[model samples]
Target: MELSELPSFDFESIIKSAVKKKDTHPVMDLPVDYEEFNLTSEFDRDSITAFVKSGGWAVGGYLEKRGVMYSAPRYADGRNIHMGIDIWAKAGEPVYAVLDGVVAYSTFQNDEGNYGGTLILKHMVEGQEIYALYGHLSKESLELHINGEKKKKGEVVGWLGEESENGNWPTHLHYQLCIEDPGEPDMPGVVAKENLIPARERYPDPRILLGDIY
Candidate 1:
């Protein structure tokens, strides 16, 4: 089946439940622009948690100014192009599988500003293979299963992690979809602006599976 034809998760329902329980901030509210406001200094774990608690979830960081953080010695222009949809929520919120797939990778990144507890699932649909990456997850999520394990659609796969374990950022889920194998437990969540076109071809918009949240 085409990517668009793949099964999708009821992200709306999940957000509704979270809002009702006060586990999340209001739905559809955009996060403060880190670029315009120069909120980089407050990008640490504590500050991010406070921001999410007060503002709700953030969407649309693709090619955003906050991409400056990811730009580094690795890229001459800096990889400020965000490749996923970040769902900011309370730590420990349960993360469910979006489709039936096998665990492709599960591990901790341990980098200061990286995906701490990460999980990558691989799925084959209509002879085409695809992958999903769930980053900054709670450490406990890694222990829930082993590599190659089969995960049914909508299964409880893991939970959001606190700053201590989730790469020292605010508790959130970095979800991405890949058309090609990332070739590792982790994939580049950001790329340089110059490479946006090609990179986008490899990693299509995750909303294809996440549904519309805008």
Candidate 2:
């Protein structure tokens, strides 16, 4: 999983988890209510794509520059490939729960992309605890999430942030699927090349439940 190199997703492993956790799964019961960048001004979309393609400082880079090393540079490899999918969208956009779970971790990591404030929910489906991550959010999003508690299927966790706080590019949500305890209050939301094997093993691919979008 090099940053510039995309790897064939391990679907068999993903399927194994799905088969084992299908009944009462956290994500299955949770419904996604967020809006994708389906309506940015036509000009905006083109500009965003061009900027990211040019590749100076975009989504992952902003995080890296600030210190979230795991944003790129896979733990298994050094090319820095990304495993979690990033969906580009607009600011103030509504981000809802994709499943029912308790807010396990929430913080304003303003440190690196600091996830520009992030949230992680944990739950058990068919008995295994699973985690969900939401990143690059608006300031208000800081207050909107379920917090040290659980949220219903359609609750608005928060809105997307504008370019500035969201780490310089257009606003969007960087969601991930994790299987770890999500760390105490604060820890690495993204991992560098040193521990990716463990992260990927615990988290698996979120797209299996999220529906591939990158």
Task: Say which candidate scores most in lDDT.
Answer: 1
Model 2 is weakest, by summed lDDT over 10 consecutive residues, at 56-65
What are the C-alpha RMSDs, in order, of all predicted structures? 8.7, 8.1
C-alpha local distance difference test of each model: 0.68, 0.55
The top-ranked prediction according to TM-score is 1
Candidate 1 error regions (>4 Å): 1-47, 63-68, 71-77
**Once model 2 is optimally superposed onto the true structure by TM-score, how far is the C-alpha of residue 103 displaced, in angstroms?**
0.9
Screening candidate 2 with a backbone cut-off below 3 angstroms (N, C-alpha, C), the clashing residue pairs are 2-81, 3-79, 3-80, 3-81, 30-98, 30-99, 70-191, 73-80, 75-193, 179-203
Candidate 2 per-residue lDDT over residues 75-169, each given as its tens digit: 23332324455665446657777667789877765543446767787756546676778777776777765556887665778777766676554
| Model 2 TM | 0.63
Question: What tens-digit string does per-residue lDDT give for candidate 1 at 1-214?
Answer: 3223334345423433432432221212233552122332334546657866664555554334353355334445566667777877778778888767899999998567788899999866545577889998988889987998998877888888888898777777888878768888887887765666666767766765665554
After best superposition, candidate 1 residue 114: deviation in angstroms? Answer: 0.5
